[model samples]
Each structure stands twice: as structure tokens, then as C-alpha cells.
Target: MDQGIVKLLPAVRGIAREAGEVILRYYTDTVTAHVKADGSPVTAADNAAEAVILPALHHLTPDIPVISEEQHAAGKSPPGDHGTYWLVDPLDGTKGFIEHTGEFTVNIGLIKDGVPVLGVMYLPVDGDTYAAAGPGTAVYGARARHDVPISCRVVPADGLVVLSSRRHGDRERLDKFLEGKLVKEHRHSSSALKFCLIARGEVDIYPRFGPTCEWDTAAGHAILLAAGGSIETPDGQSLAYGKPRYLNGEFIAYGRK
Candidate 1:
């Protein structure tokens, strides 16, 4: 199964990039956002990207069930076997995308037994991609170059480099969480880019206090895991997937853990 997953990674990356391309077709300063029942924003870019990804993913692996954001939001999720499935967020950071922040991404992750075994995250604006298939298979790429191996770096003696949500986060809670830690630098990013930054050794930790769905983190979690990092609950358990309604609680992502 690992071999099969490895073989399918390139195809998954291709699908993510293609979805990103579709998303870019809807990118503009005046992009409109519609409010979902849950009060979160959605856009045509999100739907268009999902439209590209779902069919491509189905064609690539017919047996694997897909749980995509838009599809699920529309009450059209598939029943999975619980052992293997696809989790996709066609457009993460929709607010940023609508506001011209250019921080959104196309995320695809393969989960097996509640763990993400494969992930592909593509930034449509820059054509940057981060991918992984199990451990020791993490890589980063862009239009100029592809598949450059990446890994997490040990925290420097000075302090930890941290990433926080740009659009939203529990600032008071995050401050409390970092009270005793030595933070050398603190930065803000939208969506799963924080995970990619840690995977590429640009950052050290991401302490998220607010709620997020499974699709929001799965792909980034897989890439982080493949890069020798870890994401754990507040009490220090490994973060598992396939939760009811795909909701996630607080978790901290770390590099070189």
C-alpha cells in the first residue's frame, strides 16, 4: 500500500496544481464571497477548484472516497470505508483570496486509518507546491524547479520561529500559550502555508487555538509529518483524523519533533 501511495503521489500533485489553475481563473480583486450556513465564506473559486479536483481524484483512484469542502457543504459527502479516503480543501483561506491577499491554496490529502499518508498543497498564485507520501518523502517545488527534498530543522538555541493565523486566531489564548516559550520571531500567514513553512524549515512551531476542520489541516499535517515534524493535541496526543463532522480542536504543529 505504501508503494502504491508513493506511485500515486505525482499524480496527486498534478491534480492539486490543476485545481490551483482552475482557482486562478476566478482570482480577482472583486471576487465575491457568499456566506455558508456555518457563517464561513465561500466563493466561485472554491467551487471551481473543487470541480477540477474531485473528478480528477475520482479518475485517479476510483475506490477512494473523497470528502471535499464544497461537496460536503452542499450535503453531498460520500461514505468512506474508514481505512482510506481523500480529504480536500479546494480553496483554503477564502477570505484572503477574496481580499487579494493571494494566500489561498489547493489542498489534497490521502488518509488511511485516521492518518494522512499523502498530501499535496499548491499555491496557485506562485505555482509553489509541497508534497509528501509517508515518511522521508517530503518535497517542495515551483515552476522553475520541482521535487526538492525538504525537512524540518531543529529549533535554534536563540528561540523558536512561530507562525500564527493572519485573518483569525485566538490572540489572548495564543499569547497565553506562548508565555514561557522563547520566541525569536513571530509571523502571520493564511491557510496551510504555515505548515509548509515549517516543513521547509522556515518556521519552528504553529500553535493554533481556534477550531478548524479536518480538511483544513490534513494535507499540511501529512507534509509536516513527512518532514520529521509532528502535530499534537493540547495534552500531547497525536492528532487523528475522521472526526465527527470533520471538526478539529486546538493543536500545535512543531518542527523537528
Candidate 2:
């Protein structure tokens, strides 16, 4: 684990929380959604949150370039990638936020050489934060309490507790993917919070068959890895970042085996 990355957890977590607070300010009022070029919805909260995160990250790690959802969507992305860069989804689960599901989150992750080394995910509605930097650093924090350690749990002998995306993915594909597995319970979740749940051992597996960008998964991916969990393609290869247009493919996130 890089000590430099470890040292970054605190500031990154603060940045995430700061963005979450910005989102909350808009979330409390009427959140009007507008369609982007890709036909996905974007709200004032998302832009407002990104407005908070981008400069703070630049001030914190001036050399590390940031690839943020709103900026990328607007075709304002920086040219070329640094070996180390910040991936920011100021407000993930925009659909859930629009629907008032209270499942949205603020995400920040540091990717080093195509791997996520640090992350901070903040749930604005509840003031809960999940974060980590390298192995053994995973933690769950809240407004009143901060840095309570957390890790993934081994799958139980009874069955696997699975989570599926609430608004995306094909149900047929998910069912086929789960065929023959011992599924004790299945539930729907929004945003990157699925990865946080798996990181804290609240769930066993989350299989993502839907389309997602790199920013969507990076933060949660870092926290889950720190918690002794893993994310991989269905064939069991490590997921790589820094793809063209920052896109992602289908993958499965698993807790401790």
C-alpha cells in the first residue's frame, strides 16, 4: 500500500462529504432533471456537487487530473490520462435521487496504474460514509462517529445474499447469471452503494450486467478491495480502468469467499 495514498483518505473523504452536502441542498428542494447527450438525466444537484468536488480535488492533489462525470459528459475531459487520476461521480444514482429513493451517493476514487487505490463514498441523505485506502483501511463513518473499521464477510454456507441494480440491467440476464447459485435473498439497490454494502459485509454479491461508466464503480471498488473483497469479469479477471471514454463492461462484485 502506498503511504501517499493512505494519507489521501482523509481529504478525499472530506471532499466527498462536501459534495454530498451540495447535493443535499438541491435534494431538499424540487430537483428538475434535464436530458444529456446520452439521454440520461442530469439534475442541478449533480452539477452543484461536481462544482464542489472538482476544485477541491484540484487544490488537494494539484497534479493529479480529475475525470468527473459531468465534465466528461459535457465533452470537456482533459486530454490523455495520468497514471494517477481522480474519478469523481459527484452524484451517483441520479435516477434514484430524482425519484426520491434516498439511494444516491457522492463518490471519489483514486486510480493508480489502472487500479483503484483509494476511495470515499458518501450517502448524503443519511450522512453515512464508506471509505478506504489500500488493504486493511476500510471503514464506515457517520456524522457523529467516524472511521469505524469494516470488512467483507465470507459467504455463508446457507446461501448468497445478492443485490441487483434497481433501475438498470436486464432481469433475464441476471436470472441466467444466477442460475444454480444458492441465493438466500435478493434485493434491489441504487448507485455505487451496492459496493459499499458488500464492503461492509451487509451483502454477499452484486452482479452488474448494465451499462456503467468507470466513475460509477471506482470509489466503491476501492473500498471493497480494502475490505478483502474483489470485483472481476464473469470469467474471473481483474477489472481494469482508464478505458476509452471511461466506459465499463459487465462485472461481478463479490465479498470475501
Candidate 3:
């Protein structure tokens, strides 16, 4: 494990939890979604969570710039040349939030040289967090540091458990993408929990043909990567960060190294 990351991870976990707390306030109220420039929904909760997370992340790692979803929507951006920066989705899954589903998350991921080396994801409603730092083992918890170290499991011979996005992508497209794969069941979830399930060994793979931003996958990517798994392009190459415009291409996540 990177010693620096070891020291940094705990502070980041606290920051994520604090941001989650901020989102809960909005969740309990009737949150009114405001559309962003890209036609994605936003709310007071997104702004509030980003405001709380951004400063604390800067405080924890003074040299790292935070590129947050809400901030980006407001045209606030950091230099593109930065090799180490934080990618934050202060509130992921706005539709789910509006629907009162407890599937949204607060995501903070550290990208270094185009790869996520650390991440923290918090589920506000339940206070569950799945996090990883550098090469250290990943962990899952509810309201505490961690309950257990998480690692991915191999695909079972009986078939595979797959994770699917709740309201994104076309089912037919996914069916086509999954043609010959043996799948026993599909678990539908929103936001970053799909990746957490891969890290927790609850699923074998997650394939997506839908559009997603860097913040949407970075934290989960890091946790999954650390938990003896990886994310890759359909062509089988590793997925990388720091791409043009922070956009993501179609990719699949596997619960194996």
C-alpha cells in the first residue's frame, strides 16, 4: 500500500460521510431537480454535498484539485494537465433520489496518471461505505471504519450474477452485449452500488453500453480494482481516466483480477 494513501484515505472517508450527511437533508425533504447544461438533473443536495466535500478534500490534500459534478456544471474546472486530482460525484443517481430509492451515493475518487488509485463511496440513507486506498485491500462498512475487507469471487459454474444499471441503457443492447455469457440472474441497481456489488463478490460482471461520466465510475472502479477485480473496455483493455471531457466509453467491470 502507498503510505501516503493510507494516511489520506481515512480523511477522505470522513469527507464522503459528511457529504452523505448533507445529501440526507435534501433526501428527507422534497428535492426539486434542476436540469444541468447536459440535461442531467441536479438539486440543492448536489450543490450542498459538493460544497462540503470539495473544501475538505482540498484541506486533506492541498495540492490536489477537486473536479466535482456540480462544480463542472457551473463551469468551475481545474487544469486538465493535473496528473493527480479528485473526481467527485457529490450526488449520484438523481432520479433514484427523486423517487425516494436508497440507491444514490456520494462518490470521491483519486485519479493518478489516468488511473484511479483510491476511492470512497457512501450510501447516505444507510450510512454504508465501500472504500479502498492505493494497493491496500478494500473494505465495506455501515457507520464505522469498516466491517470487513472485501474481495471479488470467481464466476460460479452454475452461471453468473450480473449487475445492471437501474434507469440507464437499453435492455436489448445489454442482451446483445451479453450474448453468450451464462447469466443466472441480473441485479438492477442505481449509481455506484453496481460496482460495490462486484467488489463485495455479490456479482460476476457489469456491462454497460450507456453514457456515464468519470465521476460515476471512478470511485467504484478503484474499489473494484483493489478488491482483486478490474474494469475494462469491451475489447479487454483496462479502462483509464483523464480522458477528453471526463466522459466514459462503454465498458465492463469484472469481479476478477
Estimate the TM-score for candidate 3: 0.96
lDDT of 3 by residue, 19-117 (tens): 989888888657798887788888889889999998898888889998888888778888657798899999998888988988899999999989999
How do all the candidates rank in terms of TM-score, highest first? Answer: 2, 1, 3
- Residues forming the 10-long window of minimal summed lDDT in candidate 1: 77-86
Candidate 2 vs 3: which has more TM-score: 2
lDDT of 2 by residue, 1-257 (tens): 89988998888888888888888878755779999989999999999999999999999989999999999988888899678999999999999999888999999999999999999999999999998999999999988885799999999999999999878868899899889999999998889999999999889999998778999999999999999999998889989899998999899999997
Q: Which stretches of candidate 3 lie over 4 Å from their true place?
A: 144-146
TM-score of every candidate:
0.97, 0.97, 0.96
RMSD of each: 1.2, 1.0, 1.3
- Position 246, candidate 3: lDDT: 91
lDDT of each: 0.92, 0.92, 0.88
> Global lDDT for candidate 3?
0.88
- Summed over model 2, clashes come to 0
